[model samples]
Target: MNKIFIIEDDVRIREELSTFLNRYGYESLFSINFENIIEEALKEKPSIILLDINLPYFDGYYICREIRKHSDVPIIVVTSRDSDMDELMSINLGADDFITKPYNTQILLARISSILKRVYGVSRGEILEYRGIIYNMAMSEVTFNNNSLELTKNESRILNILINNNGKIVSRDEIMKTLWQEAEFVDDNTLTVNVNRLRRKLEDLGAINYIQTKRGQGYILI
Candidate 1:
């Protein structure tokens, strides 16, 4: 079954979309926790995401970018902002398609079906493989040399951030935010613990110490 993660603050729109998606044989998951939108998205591993531009804790653009880091799951932006620039900006941020608000439900469903077919149906699978490791961004499942490896939520988040960067530096603050969202009571030690767990997993897989710590800088997937 395909899961569709809907991240819109408007309760009315959320309900309508969820209902429509269910009718189409999709499992639609809606989020009320604005602060944890991205975290929920990662956990759900939806087949496609319907994101709104304006959100409570953080905007949809940030969430889209965060999701892009670890998964290539199709992101079809469904927002109220209809300006040409808004559409262009969304595309630049890696959105697969952008549909402005006040749109027909049928049209929205059509766009979603199209994106899903293009990304999942046309392609053979949803997981991205690198160095014999399969990273299933949708299910957040990872397998090393064909064996399923268990990973904590935080550990999966770390891998998602690093793999998305693809040899780029991801700052510690960014990682912290991705994990903790708007919680004001996050401790540095918590992040430290997550990173340690992720490193151990990678080491067990014989992956080079590719996740490097830049003293005072941030972590990077080298």
Candidate 2:
């Protein structure tokens, strides 16, 4: 499995995406310590990196530049900001690919897959199924009980992540990562709001009470 490094401060995005990537056969590691971001990444020696422009300490561009000086690891910029200048700056700093924040899991996966294939000749793909549900990677959709839910990209991603870890508790941080996507921004508490919405939607679709919250611990699929 190819080791993919992630540099995002949003723990929700970092860990959830890491889980998704891992399920697809890539070893994903997100930076928890930002004190020596570059040093930590270099030490890990990842095949590729998903970098975010807005990081904890030093921004991604500076780190990308520093990394480029030593290694040619493929760097994909994942930024919340959308501007020509930002994209141009990322390219100038030696980033291989750039993606705007709250991106679709399919889009992100495709980018990583493409970059990995080109760089390391390795590709990762997944077709997730649990109970009666299907997570179609190509379409970024969920199919359950022969009924298709054209979910928002984040919803599909959150559902897929949860189902992949079936019978286990997934924290609010994990499920809520989906709400932070797009140009619209939702705060931390909004994760719970989104999960409640997702739960209702799932129930409305004729599914049982699949998700249950465990107070301070997290939510579990029961």
Candidate 3:
């Protein structure tokens, strides 16, 4: 069963969301201690997260950004704020989707399922190995010679696609499309920055020539 972490401070909203998710066969972990939302999320390792914009101690954007530092788990912003700015901000913070308050349960469920399918199901393959480097899609982690390589969310996603399509060129357009599918916008340089950061991490892990950039083409795992 997929685990879902809810980080809403409203007890009523949290319980309602949890119960609704449970009906859809999802195991929900509602956040009680707002001060330790990240700790709980790390401990639970949820498949998806439902976050609210108005949190108690810390805001949802902060939590989402923090989580994106290490994990690429699907996050759906469920909040009362209906502003387009809020939605865009959530996406900018790395949320997979957004749902406003008073949302239809059926629509929410559909969105959740769609995001999960696109994220964890389609983009990922089995554990990928290349040049003694191990990239585990399920765990969203990489290891080299038994030493784990810490990766950010974007780094992990980039490595996941490249390593899974080993020896094949992955178009930059394709990557940008995937990353921006949840939102209407993505900065032109965001993908470039992520690729550079990922390459640096790989180099630090003693892996060279892993990601080869093709001029006027794309990137390939070599």
Best by lDDT: 3
Q: Please identify model 1 stretches exceeding 4 Å from their true place.
A: 122-222
**TM-score, one value per model:** 0.54, 0.58, 0.54
lDDT tens digits by residue: candidate 1, 29-133: 987988877888878888888889999988988888888997888898888889899889888989999998787554455466557767777322244445545
Q: Candidate 1: which pairs clash?
A: 69-164
lDDT of 3 by residue, 1-222 (tens): 888898888888888888977865778997588898888887898888888889888898999999999899889999899899999999999998998888756456656666777676832223556777776555566776556666777788888788768899999888877666743377767888999988887888788778899988889989
- How close to the true structure is residue 147 of candidate 3, measured as C-alpha lDDT? 66
**Which candidate has the top score in TM-score?**
2
Model 2 Cα shift for residue 8 (angstroms): 0.8
Listed per model in order, the count of residue pairs whose N, CA or C atoms clash below 3 Å is 1, 1, 0
Query: lDDT of each structure?
Result: 0.77, 0.78, 0.80
Error of 1 at 183 (Å): 68
lDDT of 2 at 193: 67
Best to worst by TM-score, what's the order? 2, 3, 1
